[model samples]
Structures are given as C-alpha cells and as structure tokens.
Target chain A: MRRPISLALAGLLLSASGAAAGPERVAFPAGYQDGFVRYLDVDRPDRKIKRLFYVNPAALETAKAGDPLPDGTVLIMEDHPVELDGEAPRRDAEGRFIATPEVTNVFVMEKQPGWGEAYPADTRNGDWDYAWFDAAGTLKHSDPERYAGCFNCHQSRAGRDFTFTFFKYVEDLKR
Target chain B: MGRCLALAILFSGLASAGQAAEITVGMAAADYTPATVEARVGDRLVFLNDDSVDHNVFVPTAGHAVDLGKQVPGARSELPLGKAGAFEVECVIHPDMHLQVRVVR
Candidate 1:
C-alpha cells in the first residue's frame, strides 16, 4: 500500500525529460501590476508595443549586481500596444511611446533555488522558471519550447546573473 | 557524339559548382570574429560561442528571419542557407554585434 502511494507521488514530480520542478512551481503573481516596483519601460516603435518591466519590491531592495538575484526573486513583464495616431505611434513629451491601458500579455520569470532541475543541462537557467499569464492573470501557453526561450535568451547574460534589466535595477538600487 | 561530350562537361561543371562548404564563425568579446562570411547556396553557417558569456544569433533579413536561440560558452549551432542573398547576423542580447554573410549560388 505504501509503495503504490509513493509511485503516484513520484509520477507527479516527473517531467517528460525526467526533470522535476517545471513551470508548475510558478503561480500567477496576482496584483503584481500595482504592488511590484516598476523598473523598466521598453518601447518598441517598430512593433508599436511597449513593455513595462516590474520586479517585486523585495528583490529591488535586496538584490545585487553581478550576483544571482535571491532565490525568491520574481520579475514580471507586462506588454501593451502603444497608443497610435493613424499609422504612427503617438509619443509623449519625452519621445517615449504612450502605452495603452489594455495589457496584451503578462510574462513572469521567477527564480527559486533548485528549479534548475526543470530543464536539460544545456539550456537550463541557473534557477529561474518562466510562465505566461493572460491579462486576467490566468496561466496560458506554458509549453517548454516556448518557455525554453526564457532560458536561452537569459543564458546569454549569464554574466549579469542571467538578467537584462535586473542589473539596471541593481544600478538604481546603489544610487 | 559531340553533343554527348558537351552534356558531360555541363554535368561536371554543375557538380563542382555547389559543393556546400561548412563555415564556422566564432563569437567572442561580444563580437563575431571574421565578421564577414561568404557562403554558397546550400552551405551551413556553424556558429561557435567562444566567449565566456552567453550569446545568440538572430538573422532578421526579410524572408530569411531566424533566431538561433541562446548559445552558452562553447556552444555550437548550424544555420543552413536555403537561398542566395546577403543577410546580417546579429545577437539578440548584444544588439551591436553583427555578422554579415553574403551567399551566392
């Protein structure tokens, strides 16, 4: 009887590649839009899109540059279609695109120690897991190949502890 | 007999014209060394990440866009040239790093 229950528990943790700790480890960070500290706002005039990057204030207060962010670090990327005039993107006084209120998608990259086991060795990010949630905070499109991009793109920045904007946030933290 | 000899020469020329070589480009110092590569149609571009940091290749040339996602140190990936044209290879993370490859049939 004990053996049967243990077998079922083991199956729950196993992934297709025999790895544990997949995207299930990440839950949608409800209310992150307002509660998290906005760190970066990237505008893509080419696509008429704007991305608002946010990090949980806890990480902004504690993380350092050139070092892996703390295990509990949670970073959120919110994408919006920029406000447009006819065919051109309308810009604010600073020349930054004016972001529309309706969010297109929300992507979250969260790190926790030992989460590295979720991916194969070649593409595994140190300890980060990524998830896609709709604007309503419902998780969607959680395929490994799509999520693999998070590891692949971030892996190139291994020097910055596998982050692009986080180091900038760290820079702001120092000042 | 004369026509047969001409056909044989034509076949030989076609066979020798496109051998499809494999060219390796190394990435280091956040740049692709030998930044310009010349390749023939059907050839392959082998990208080797020689840098200590991570790098990626994205060729955004119209009709030939491809993203060779994350390459860690010592990593290698191959991009096959299916058409003949000049395409610019760039790193998604290090936007400034560029490799120009001119392909011909």
Candidate 2:
C-alpha cells in the first residue's frame, strides 16, 4: 500500500533541496578530520561546546613535545547542546554524550607559517586562523575586529603553545 | 518453594523477551551513511556521529519522533524503537541529511 504523503513531509522534501551541505565556500580543510586524535572532552555550560575536541596528529605531537605548532596544524572543536535521554543527561557513564546530538556548530583553528606576520602585532595569534562552520557546513562570517577574541583567548596560554589543551595533552603523553 | 521457583523462572523469561537488539546508524559528512535500515519493534537504534561536525537525528512520527540532542564526532545517541512503521529521519540543522528506517512487528 502507498503511504499517504502529508503536507509536512512534502514541506520537508522541498526544504531539503535548498539546504546547505558544502564546505567549499570557506575552503574548509575537508577530510582532515580522519585519523585526528581526540585529546579532550569538555562540557561547557556557558558556551556551545556540548562535548569534544580533536587535534591533528602532528599538532598533538608537537604540543606534547613542548614545541610550537607548525603551519597547517588544525584543531577541531565539536559542539552540541545539552540533552536528556531519561532522568540523566544522555551520556555514557564516562560522560560522553551517547545519543546522536544536534551538532550546532563546529569551530576550527589552523596555523599557517608566517601568516601572523600579516596581522598587527597587537592582534596576531601566532600563525593561527580561525573559522567557524555552522551545522550545515556553511561558513559563518565574523567581524574582523571580533577576531581579536580568538587570539586573546589563546594568548593566556602562551606558555602552552597558545592552547588550553596543551596541559591535557602533556598528561596524556605520560600515559 | 516450587511456586517461588516457577515465578522466578517466569520473570527471567519476561526479562529476556524484553531485551532489545541494537542497530547503529551513522551520521557523516552531511548525511546518514546508511540512509535505509530495517528493524523490528523493541529493537534499539543507535545514532553514531562520524562527521567532524555536530548532528541531531530526529524523526517526526509520534512514538518514533526523537530529538537526539547534539552529537559530536564519535559520540552516539540511542532511540528505542517502540512502534512498527516507516520513519523518515532527518537532521534538523542540516536539512540535506536524511535517513529512512522501516520497523516491523
């Protein structure tokens, strides 16, 4: 028997065609996430980070050795919202969200050799470039002035390769 | 003693019967990797995120409708299949992502 197509289903099908699905606009480093190592999982109540972070292999190794991240190092921060499956948060005993979550956004930080030279000394984040992709893989444009926030946040961790995850990676290196 | 043992055996059987089988559906690069799947009522659906981005798996049907909060890459979410029917699953954030699941008795 043919299942009747309802108005909602019809609407969804129409909307699907116009949805965003390509990362080409921003030149996002596609397929770079494969083989990347997850070094941390953080639950942020204040930010969009519902829970994990992955770092490229060479970048992770560089950070562990207490060296500066070379050009082309990329870090991916995964974003999710808090959700519940029953009484508790929908997560495994280890606190990793176990259910398919609505991925709200993805943030990327990449370093390029000498790229920081173009920025004024006051605004530079070493050679790092930050880009954000919304759930649909569409690039989210941010004001250039606001870009200061990215470098400023990382500046606090200058001793640790300008990244907050450095100390965590140090611990992992020992293990 | 015989009656108590019989009750225990019946409860054990009931528990075993209630156990649900699990199937995994992965969310990857803007879509569900395996867009179609067949399952039975009382089975479980595990939504796995294989994309670098975040994703939410949702179906609109009453009992089958679920809001998989937000899945980071490598994370998983589960839905308990309670009804027998066809469910069209989509990621609300990425309308381009779609999946279809058929559940049987």
Candidate 3:
C-alpha cells in the first residue's frame, strides 16, 4: 500500500525525524492522486473555484458519521479554476461553473498515530500534518513557520478530528 | 428539484437585513470564548486575540470564506457574515481554538 515518496518530501521527512520537526511527515500524493477517491466538489465566488476533494480509501472504509477519521487517512484537495469568459465564468444550462482540467494548486492532509508528537499542543492537529504543492506536484514551501500555520489553522476543527471536510467525506461514503 | 438547485435558491440573493449587530469573540488561553455562536445574516464578527502568541482567523466556507492570516497578539479583525449558513471558524495555529457560526435570516 506504500508508494514511492516524493524526493523533496522524503528529504524533509528524514530531517524531521532527526531534528527539525515539521510537515516533512506529509508526502506529496503519488501521481498527485493515486489511491485517493474524489468525494466532494466546492464552488467559490469571484474566481469560481471548483475544488475537487479526494480522500484515501482507508478513510472511507473506517470512518463513521460524527466521529474522527481513522488514523493514516490522507485527504487531497485539488483546485481547478473554472473556465472563464472575461472575468465571469461561463456556465452550462444548469448554471454550474465548468472546472478546468488543469489543477492550479493541491493541498495534502494526513493523519497518523503519532505524527503530532513533535509539535506543541497549540499547533498540533491531533496527528494530522499538512503540505502544499503546485500544479506540478512540487513542494512550494520550506519554512518551518509556513507549516506552523497549517497546524494552527486546523486546530479549530479539533472536534472533527482537526479537519473541515472529513465529515462530508463520511457522508459521501454513506451514499 | 435537486438538492443543489434548492440550496442555490436558498442562499441566492441578499440575505434579509433588519438589524445588523456586531459580535465580539475573545481568544485567550489558546481558545475562543463562546465557541458556538448563533447570529443573523449581515452581522459582523470582531475577533480579539489576547493569547500570548500570534493567532489567525480563517473561514473557508464557500462564498463567505476569509483568511486573516497570521494575526499577532492583541490584534483584531472583522468579518461580515453576508450569507445564511452554518460554518466553522478556526485560528489555524491552535488546535483548541474553534468557532462555530450559524447565521440565519
């Protein structure tokens, strides 16, 4: 079930396990989405962001409604800006924005049994860690401070296992 | 009608506005006081961070999402709730600090 790790993420993880603890624990999803299932789509304003949310099969199988996601769950968010005419997006007859096939940004969130042990309580998302990548699946940040925000931001969702969308994924699995 | 179409009609157009008020949220002890709030659309949220370290305010709920990134201690930010829905707000830096907002017409 383990795939080849991204070289950049692997290098960071090597460092994290030794001394510098950070999001190095997270790996860029293989093929940007291998072994992940797309569960939800969100449309934003202005830019018409059509976000495709993918969750690891482990999460789908083990998750229960209104409960925390199982450990080792990996969630990937892929941003596909809607096709636009001028500043407004062109829609089909149903008035739904059409998302471009090209992904603009990707965010990865993963949870393990002891991943948060290196972080302090204030910045730990339980055992979850976050990493960001560009369309080409290249890690875009190397600063420790940058990863700190990921933990801090997701802290609010502690009641939901520190995730904003895992419940929706569980709901999707039900259907 | 489909669920999406029903929701589209529900959230579309200007949310009803009779009286708009400001709600204050205090961040201290690495937590948001009154973690759950029930308010009306067109209301404004003011966040005051009194925690020792820096905190943040981010809402990624579709049309109303806002990111007041990297808010230092003693900082304040305002967010206008323009839509009627249930959404979650987080400091992003702290796991225990979260705010649940339910805005109704």
Which digits, one per residue and each the tens of the lDDT, describe model 2 over residues A59-86? 6665535566655677787677766655
Candidate 2 residue lDDT tens string, B28-61: 6677856787776777777777678988665543
TM-score of every prediction relative to native: 0.59, 0.47, 0.57
Residue B69, model 3, lDDT: 61
Index of the highest-DockQ prediction? 3
DockQ of 1: 0.05
Top lDDT: which candidate number? 1
- On a 0 to 1 TM-score scale, where does candidate 2 land against the true structure? 0.47
- Classified by CAPRI criteria, candidate 1 counts as incorrect
Docking class of 3: incorrect
* Candidate 3 pairs with clashing backbones: A152-B92, A152-B93, A152-B94, A153-B92, A153-B93, A155-B95
Clashes of each: 1, 13, 6
lDDT of 1 by residue, A1-175 (tens): 4433332343245543445554555778888878999777765544678778888888887887556688789998888998889998776653456788989889888887666654556666777778888899877864454565566677766766677666645754464
Q: Each candidate's DockQ score against the native complex?
A: 0.05, 0.02, 0.13
In model 1, where do residues sit more than 4 Å from their true spots? A1-20, B1-91, B95-105
Ranking by TM-score: 1, 3, 2
lDDT of 3 by residue, A26-143 (tens): 7787763667877666555434677778888877888887777888898888888888889976654433467888988888888777676655555556767677888887787855
Per model, how much of the real contact set is kept?
A: 0.07, 0.00, 0.13
